[model samples]
Target: MFGDMMNMMGKLKETQKKVEETKKRLDSVLVDETSSDNKLKVTLTANRTIKSVEIDDELLEDKEQLKDYLILTLNKAIEKATKINEAELAATAKEGMPNIPGMDMFK
Candidate 1:
């Protein structure tokens, strides 16, 4: 029993390291979103950090329209980044989990 406990602890440590590495990798994963007419675009990392925003000259004419476009496009980009971040982290965690009795049910 003691040996099994030690092994499980080691596995958990390894999993933690892998999770941190996965997070760093996610920083480079980019997600892009654009307004319907393509007047506005946004890019974000899987970490949900905004990378860039591009706006068309026409959008500059109306501040309200630009605000709306930025909100819509940025929200979409954030949603995509969140999905990617969650999925990647989940997969990494699942992959590293130590197999134990009845844990298959969670998988």
Candidate 2:
């Protein structure tokens, strides 16, 4: 019984280490999304924070249109970023807990 307890404690420590490594890797990941026309772009961190946005000079000619395009582009970029983050998180969670049921729910 004592050996079993020690083995479980070791496994828990290993899992904790893996979780920390995954967090660090996720923090370092970045996702970039752009509009179809390339007039607008957005960079997002793995945690889904907007890092930056860019707009082409040609779009500046029409202020109203530029504004609309920017909004649309930003929304699309955010959506893309969200999907990427979700996929990555799912993958990481699966890798960390392959045999555990409902493991991703904690993520």
Candidate 3:
């Protein structure tokens, strides 16, 4: 029983390491989003860090419109990045989990 516990602990440690590595890798995974009219564009990493924002000169004329475009586009980009981040981390965690009884519910 103690040996099993030790093995499980070791596996968990390995999983933690892998999850960290995956997070680092995700920093390079870019997600792009654009406004419906193509006046604004955003780029972000799977880690949800904004890398760049491009706006058409037409948008610079209207502060409110630019704000709305930024909010909508950034939200969409964030949602996409969040999905990628969660899926990747969950998959990594599940992949490294030891076969313990009654854990299938998590799947």
Candidate 4:
């Protein structure tokens, strides 16, 4: 029983290391999104950092429209970032798991 505890602890540390590495890499993963009319563009990191934004000249004329487009673009950018983060996590989860569906929550 003692040996099992030590082994589990070792694996937990290893998994923690992998997760940290994955998170670091995720911080640099970028996703670009545009509004439905392609008037606004936003670039986002998987860590939810906005790296860049571009808006059409027409959008600059109307404050309300620009705000709406900016919001739409930001939301889409966040969604893209989330999907990438989930994919990276799933890939990380494929390495040396404990064969338990809920095991990752412990990490």
Model 3 misplaced stretches (Cα beyond 4 Å):
none
Tens digits of per-residue lDDT, candidate 3, 1-107, equal: 99998998999999999999999999999999999899999999999999999999999999999999999999999999999999999999999998777887766
Model 1 Cα displacement at 49 (Å)? 0.3
Per-residue lDDT of candidate 4, residues 12-36 (tens digit):
6777788789989998888999887
Residues 6-89 of candidate 1 have per-residue lDDT tens digits of: 998899899899999999999999999989999898999999999998999999999999999998899889999999999999
Please give the clash total of every predicted structure, in order.
0, 0, 0, 0
Cα-lDDT of candidate 4: 0.83
Model 2 score (lDDT)? 0.73
Measured by TM-score, the strongest candidate is 3
Give the Cα-based TM-score of candidate 2 against the true structure: 0.61
The TM-score-based order of candidates, best leading, equals 3, 1, 4, 2
lDDT of 2 at 71: 83
> lDDT score, residue 11, model 1?
94
- Report residue 53 deviation for candidate 3 (angstroms): 0.4
Candidate 3, run of 10 with poorest lDDT: 98-107
Q: Which candidate would rank higher by lDDT, 1 or 2?
A: 1
Provide TM-scores for the models. 0.94, 0.61, 0.96, 0.84
